[model samples]
Target: MSLYGEFSVPTDAFALHYTLEQIQEITIETERVVATEVGLTNYFWVSGCNLDEFETVSEKDPSIQNLRRLDEFDRATLFRAEWTEQVDAIIFAYLEIGATILEATGSHDEWHFCMRFDTHDRLDQFQDHCDDQGISFRLTKLHEITQPHTGSQFGLTEKQSEALVTAWKMDYFTTANVTLADVASELGITPQSLSERLQRGYQSLIANTIVVTPPSD
Candidate 1:
């Protein structure tokens, strides 16, 4: 059976360490990643800082290369960059073990990652590889993916599902009577965390359901 794992790692132990140090208030969330021959190409969103300053500081981040602005939103800017393969052993380990990164978000202090593995053995191998590389992380959650036609079917993590369901039950989408804070309180998590889960969950659902492409002829 497939397994899902959630982990947290300090920013200094992962990518964009220098950028985060320079811009303490900024937050980052990865949009996509593709493995290249020599490195990983990434698309991510950044907010809470000057985009130009973020670009300036990114030049000094040894983990990043070829950083470019891709799009601008009301609150966040999208960027594309190449991450040097040698700098992020944790990500490389995931590549080696065929683990899928479902979502990754980072702040000045740390990064939270949700990943899926084909089996328990693959998860174990990923942990062993991280240990061998001296890469440290806190495993916050882990569980087997037992149902494909339900929660995992839409690519939503357990936490995301909980947040979405709870918010729905509270009529968060139907009425203004319930606020994000109210839903967060019900879930026993901070509003910011709840917001992240809801956003990621929405994205997962849209990607898995609404954005499908028909098979090529």
Candidate 2:
């Protein structure tokens, strides 16, 4: 079975916001999953997952801390992908039940625009929810994800992938100029969180991509 899936629709599929307070609440509830699942159907492209519905939380009020290997975000997403046999399920259906909205702070504190949802869904469900909510969420089908598209190819998540990339991008020599605070700002996350992501990414990078760059003449 495919791990990640993507779908596409008209450009004006999901509106970022609405005027009505009720609509806003719907936005908030569904948003709890995150906007990552908004556009793309594929698992990798889809950003967030239903943190509230996570098994840890479901079993007995398992908080975000229950997740072990990955952060809350990655665990939630993985749960969705692996929880169900069908990879293309409607992750946002939880919204109709008034799922609690956990505003996504920002993605990996990497970029301003990068956002993720704690939700996962098939491209079809994502589109339908957009329609049901009177929004314009769409789907973009990906013909193929580039080789080494991400660490998931090697059983790694985006955060893991970033750590790998960042380490290679910077020599262990120094990110002295680029403080954790700066990285966090770039990623729209707190410095401490950035450090965690960086450390994980660095370890993965070292494990997978550790190699010496040719010395400059």
Candidate 3:
């Protein structure tokens, strides 16, 4: 008794984030044009009452979880109706899980959001769900957009892998860190050449990694 047949939510399709709760919040801000902001038409939620003590803990206290639908187009009405449908789907899924949540609260022609929480193992389960659904969900210890200098998992040349690993360990971020020139000196290569190699390594890793954010275009 349904629209198509049985609720065949493709075993492959799952949620993006592993848990309903998260600590660091990623604020993706965009400049509003004539339309100002894209609004979420509405969101639907269904709840899961089965989880035991964890549910109680989540109910009493929850963390911040956010996913902003960051997309942009010069013109407004480009993907109008379809955008609303996607937002609705997010709401429905969160509600079904007994997750503490925030339904889409803002409006922007191309922006939308939804959030929820779960912890540790529960978070892992959430990530599994995202994997099945083909959504890219990754948690980071640092909030900045980091360029990982690691090689892709499938395959990478030894030198390429080493270059990427070096990029990650450079401590290029902090004030008291050594410069690329210092590392390059140890490697017997000029800093300029080292930078080029690091760039290549970061690009390779990015091509295969699962982290997803707003469209960079």
Candidate 4:
């Protein structure tokens, strides 16, 4: 039976910690971490930072294989980067243990990983690898593949889910109620960050639940 495991690794222990310090919000999609001869190249989108600064910091990092901007939006910037072996080994350990990565996201704070494997033994192998390497991480979730992916049904991160729920309960989503700033204050995040989180969460919800069908021919 396939199983899913989720883990959190501190930014201090993650490879892209420096990049996170430069950018504000990074939303990772399913498509990530393609390994290459040089290293593992990954793609993601970020918001609330000067592109030039991101480029500069990434350029100086030896672990970064290559960094390039793919797209620009009013609020977010899309980017791709190849990472060196130093980082790739940590993530690919699951692969070595016969597991597949379903989702991976890194931020200034930490990295969140969701992976699937055929058996508990594989997961145990992964855990053993982490312990042998003395890698610091927290296994936040684990379940049989029978259960849906966390946030997969809703297209929201744990933090985003909490923020949205709090906003709704506080009447921030209702008319003549709290302002974005007020909600942000309650969440202890800046208004801009809160706005981005809400926007992304709503977009995910729409994409996942509101599928439109074409008229029958």
Pick the TM-score winner: 1
Candidate 4 structure quality by residue, lDDT tens digits, 1-217: 7787899877646566766755656433333345555445666666556778777777766656667787665677667777664464356563466566556777777878877777998778777877776777699888886744556445455556767888998998786768999889999999887887676677557645785442342
**By lDDT, is 2 or 3 better?**
3
Model 4: how far residue 133 lies from native, Å: 1.3
Model 2 — TM-score against the truth? 0.33
The residue-level lDDT of candidate 1 at 57 comes to 91
What stretches of model 3 exceed 4 Å from their correct place? 1-155, 211-217
Query: Which candidate has the highest lDDT of all?
Result: 1
Question: Candidate 3 lDDT, tens digit per residue, 168-214?
Answer: 57765454577888778766777765775565455435544544442
TM-score of each: 0.71, 0.33, 0.26, 0.61
Predicted structure 2: lDDT: 0.33
Residue 186, model 2, lDDT: 56
Between candidates 2 and 4, the one scoring higher on TM-score is 4
Please report, in order, the local distance difference test score of every candidate based on alpha carbons: 0.80, 0.33, 0.34, 0.67
- Model 2: per-residue lDDT, tens digit, 140-217? 333333353456333344654565465546543374665556556655777666665555445434534553442342
Task: For residues 124-210, write the lDDT of model 1, one tens digit per residue.
Answer: 888787787777868999998787754655766667878998998899999999999999999998887788677767876886789
C-alpha lDDT of candidate 4 relative to the true structure: 0.67
